[model samples]
Target chain A: MKLEKGVLLTCDPAVKQILLMLNNRQPFILQDLDEFHVVIKAELEAWVRSQLETELEKNTYNLE
Target chain B: MAMQKGASSSTSVKTAQHSLLPFLQTQSQQSLTRLYQRPSSCLSIFRLLDPLSRQLILNLLWLESPVPLSVMTAWVTTEGTRAFDDAVSILTKLHILPNPSVKLSLSPTFKASMRQAIIGGGTTASFGVPADAENKKPPSPANLDAYALERWETILHYMVSSGRGQRPREPSRGVIKLLTDSGLMSGSEAAPQITSAGFQFLLQTPHEQLWQLLLRYLVMAEERGIDLIEVLSFLFMLSTMEFGWDYSTSSLSPTQEVLMEDLRDYGLVWQRKAKSKRFSPTRLATTLTSSLPSLPTSSSSSTNTAAVASGTGATSEGFIILETNYRVYAYTNNPLQTAVLHLFVNMKSRFPNLVIGMITRDSVRRALANGITADQIISYLAAYAHPQMRKFNPLIPVTVQDQIRLWELERERVKSDSGYLYQDFQSLGDYTTLVDYARQMGILLWESPAKRCFFIREDGHNVMKQFIERRKVSGGG
Candidate 1:
């Protein structure tokens, strides 16, 4: 067994897929756990979150 | 602290207000024992205890010896065991009661001092000695009330006006220092800016706000090389003092004399002049430990019509009306209230008794940027919701509440938890066993059976490692 310290991010599988795509551009995930979870670099968790938010914001409908 | 949990559980609507109980719980046992050395501190701490704890203490106060655990347990009904346990736990934490096994009793110092406080024959004069009746022109209670309201309002108005980017009359240097040191305000001493915590402080009842400031003042006092016991005993003594009664300053210890200066800044006590030999405990000081409203309620004191006309009368009552369309109508001419509302509402118009505003996306975003949470805004609105609006179950309109929350949620898209990720298990059985063990230990954060991986909290890594090593050895055997 192997153990490593990092931030655990759990989300929808679709969100995980997007995160994987983003990881290709700039590595933030330390290890991919499964379809819905990944171990992210603790320091980059904020950056990864903001990246995901920006990505999700594009597809969302804005009334204003 | 346990008492607060018990109180919150029973009355879910009443948010836990700031009190000296939580502050005292954080003190060292030696400090707490020293605090209980005074009769006034004993009485004051007793008053602050939850009802169940007070009952238990009273039952054991005069006992010559410890009571049997079973006998004390029998006094509480089965339905009250939870509250009883909570009360006992708080008492033990405060060191008011000795640890329980087969018997329970109040601590020796606390019991003796508490007895003296009740029986009243101590030469120590833990209660203040009244000044001689030589000063024939002592301020009446009504004048003291107005003085306290003005002094307190000045501090509050300073905080509110700072948020509006305007400069009002600044409070004393000590008050400003306490405000900044407490994280209620940020920025320089010359131009302190109000923080989100300051905004929440504005919404709290005057009693809670005073306690919050005093707790911070205690911390400030400790850093200044002043005796904590002296400050705490003075505060408790002030609580027990009668409003309008002048206490001689000559009897105060040197540390308490310094504390008197700071307390005067907060309007807790009124002194005719800095060199006065005696000072009167204002309404704020007397109401410190009691359940009485710190500020004069509109219904209680009609004699303070000047206070009412000055807009201080709205301190305790609800005066806000929030509608479904997000329009906010506040029937308060109080500038302090208006400035607090201005924090999160886009003001449109103001009349004699009403202010109109709107809770818009930009307005809420502004508040959010200032570090104010959605729940704080919603609760502040709900707390001061107009009587008509309070008829609803949730107080504030559900739509407005949900919208404010959604705006806050937009900023918090991801939650992060640091832990150890366990992967590359040798077998499904090993993975399942380890996962079950982690779950049993209540340290499991996330897991995936298919991937043969799981996450355990950072603090549990050592325990999990020991478990794995033991399992390996046993399986090898």
Candidate 2:
């Protein structure tokens, strides 16, 4: 979970894969994320929130 | 990875060279000499050598003079002396070591290059350069894994689904041409079909399959006038990069830039766009130099990525069940695995999560016709056999193994080898000398002492020819 000063923290390919699948707008159940280790769960949750914010910002800017 | 049971069984016939090591070992001296110029290539080659060979190479690397044979033999335990000799022969054959009879010494070029790799003081930038901080988020490892799987599976699907009357998404033209050139597929793109070599390819381990394609790409690159040396050095370098991080493409040569495009197409890297300044190595690229067992446990099954990505604990490593009666119950939802299984199995039924198949004499013989050997199929089965079955001494049922070999041997009774026949020497001494030389070189296939003639493999013809020419020059003088 340690992120270097400027470097982005990279997740396991499996974790990145789950986040990328979110782009398809498919709803994943809790059991799905549970399959990953507890450490990656936090990272993935953070990534999902950030993805949500990016999507929300894009919509707001488009409307403006 | 499970040890190949058939490989250990002396009864099985010899399998064709399905690995990169044999191909590397057979390279001409000029190619090896040119290849040794790059430190990364030397390091990669060094890694592939036997452990004894590596230790021997290290001992000789800094030595100013050659270590005599007697001194070299004393370094290893008595039991390892034979393996030591084998290591020396392999090194000499690959031109890594010189003058085995008199003394062992590293090739000057290899010593210097390998030293440079170890000490890490060089401007070659043979290892890729890390990019500066980027604002955009790097693609997640899972996504890259998925992308690689999707892209690679698409190619396999194109090959496997050719005659099924269903077109899975086809791979690009470049990949198709690659397959065609590699002799995996034949005929026009409009109706491409898998050749027997393709079937044999389908049965190889995932790592071996990846290298086969990459090796073909290297050849394709050379054909387009790209410097093969630079391309190879870059490939060896890619195997060493950290996964999931961006590397700057600015420092790459023009040849690497083009090579990068093709690698991207093959799903080894991810770039935001064709002209992106930074690219990330996917799991495929990172696992290049890793041993078979060391590849990500989850990435073993490409088709299961979606399931695994969704946090399902399923892995692709072992899902096959082979019964004593030759019935195969493969627990696979991936079409690619199913297609590969269908190649040799008389697939009786297909379910959502399982495929029921039986290995029959006809089916195996048909596979044999397609260039897939009995040994390859048995090894493939043993490699993917169920976890329960893996605990057994022989992974597959012993009876089934013997039956498959029996089926293959029935057809193999009349075998063919295309090689050069050397005979009709002017003297017995001359014939004996050439035969002895061929044996030393390990290229003599068969010989008849009565007729003073022998056969050497086609590729070994060049070595034999060169030896005779050198002998003629020396004898004339």
Candidate 3:
């Protein structure tokens, strides 16, 4: 599904997981990406990488 | 899942809160980052936001550079500072605004997606397509509206009537399961009993009722291994679909086809035959994005149905007139309306086209016990306030509203919170700074100056921990 522009469309399972959570009524924080086993398209891969990186930073900050 | 169900006594009161905007706000950052990938979802969310939030989003949308919090606050009127801050905080919570204090700008994905929806030139077909050009007959708006109202109320009637020892047309098995799964009802499908959530569901506005059910449907669909993105896009696409027009189901994906069938049962769509290739979107489907919760002509469908079934011309504007003496004069004979009113009203008399009831302290408290809040009852009344009563400065008397709230508040004499209690401090200076930080973040639930102790919400721990970390790093630097 074309959830965002500038990202190549792929039938990635991770996208499906994201879609499920997006529709979820209750709040959830993204904790693990390993749970979503899907290939990320090259262009979108960079965005995913950055997202994980930012989350990592935030988690580390809290730990500190 | 238990949290949403609010099975716990302490959380039962707070957990019942559900709305599209708050739902979006609680989404995971990853999910939101992906959700904003679609222009339609962006626009849908933007439409759902409050007016102040909309203004804030638009202001940030067109910015060439990130604006500081001070600059943004300066743009708002002095009286609107709180609203401005609330809007920014909501945006921030949704990750739509990365940072409010440092800078304000729409998230990259939302910015692009919203821009696309407004300009409207995308092959994504996100707005929906008129798939059937060869339809022999298109459904009329009035027919579609009536069908929608009838089917929707069938579900409502099923819930209310079953509880009140009356037999109404049985709702579909899927609809029954939805109510049961959402914790709105319990018991076997044929004899489902209304739960506290069911009472709250009955009191919600039509639009909210629709969204809550639809959201539950999404979860159910996901469990069935249906693609949620396809279902969600189709749902959003329905919101944009033209009312009373036939759309071909031929082009729909397998998942969408499944959704279309479910929509038909809910009366959001009409199919002449079970295998019909074309479906006409009903008013319920078309008005999904509408901000107005009440339909002008059809909001009183309960009364209309009652009039038709009884062969009487009970003309009324779907208004509930409340007097200062706690007497309620409702201008309809709809059993469903009467059943819902019976939840919180002590009926004294009933007429062919009218029901008179008194809103007593016991009744209000009973409704509260049923998990229906006073605000919900007041809003329900305000939403259906008689046109003649609308001329009044306040639709319901202020004294009556206050009394209802006061009665409900009596139960809140003992409050409960699940949070972390902080007491030990190395020094008074350390306690002072941490307390100040917690208060500023609006996470401080309680504090005592003498003990140098404070209580904060559980979620506040991460921020507090990070704040201490930041102080250490800065001081060391």
Candidate ordering by lDDT (highest first): 1, 2, 3
The TM-scores of all predictions, comma-separated, are 0.82, 0.68, 0.63
Q: How does residue B352 of candidate 2 score in lDDT?
A: 79
Q: Model 2, which residues run further than 4 Å from truth?
A: A1-64, B1-34, B64-66, B76-82, B98-103, B163-165, B293-307, B310-314, B409-477
lDDT of 2 by residue, B11-102 (tens): 33222222566666677778788888778788887776666777888888888888888887776798887877778888888888867888
Of 1 and 3, which scores higher on TM-score? 1
Two-chain complex of model 2, DockQ on C-alpha atoms against the true structure:
0.01
Which candidate, 1 or 2, would have the higher TM-score against the true structure? Answer: 1
lDDT for B365 (candidate 1): 80
Give lDDT tens digits, candidate 1, residues B171-256: 99999999999999999889999998987788777888999999888888889988888899999999999877878887799878
lDDT of 2 by residue, A10-34 (tens): 2345444544566357542222212
Ranking by TM-score: 1, 2, 3
Candidate 3 lDDT, B1-477, residue by residue in tens: 322222244344333333666666666788777777777778777776777788888877877788877787778898888877777788888889886778788899889888888898877666666665663878666566667767877898888766767778887888989989999999876798989889989987677789899888877887898866677667767777777688877667887887787888888888889888778887787778765432324444554553354333333454589998889998876677888888899888999878999998767877897889887788778767787788886567888888888877655432334355666677888889989999999987666677566667767778988998898899799
Query: Going through the candidates in order, what is chain B's TM-score?
Result: 0.83, 0.76, 0.70
By DockQ, the better pick of 1 and 2 is 1
Choose the strongest candidate by DockQ: 1
Q: Give the TM-score of candidate 2.
A: 0.68
- DockQ for each candidate? 0.64, 0.01, 0.01
Quote the lDDT for B161 in model 1: 90
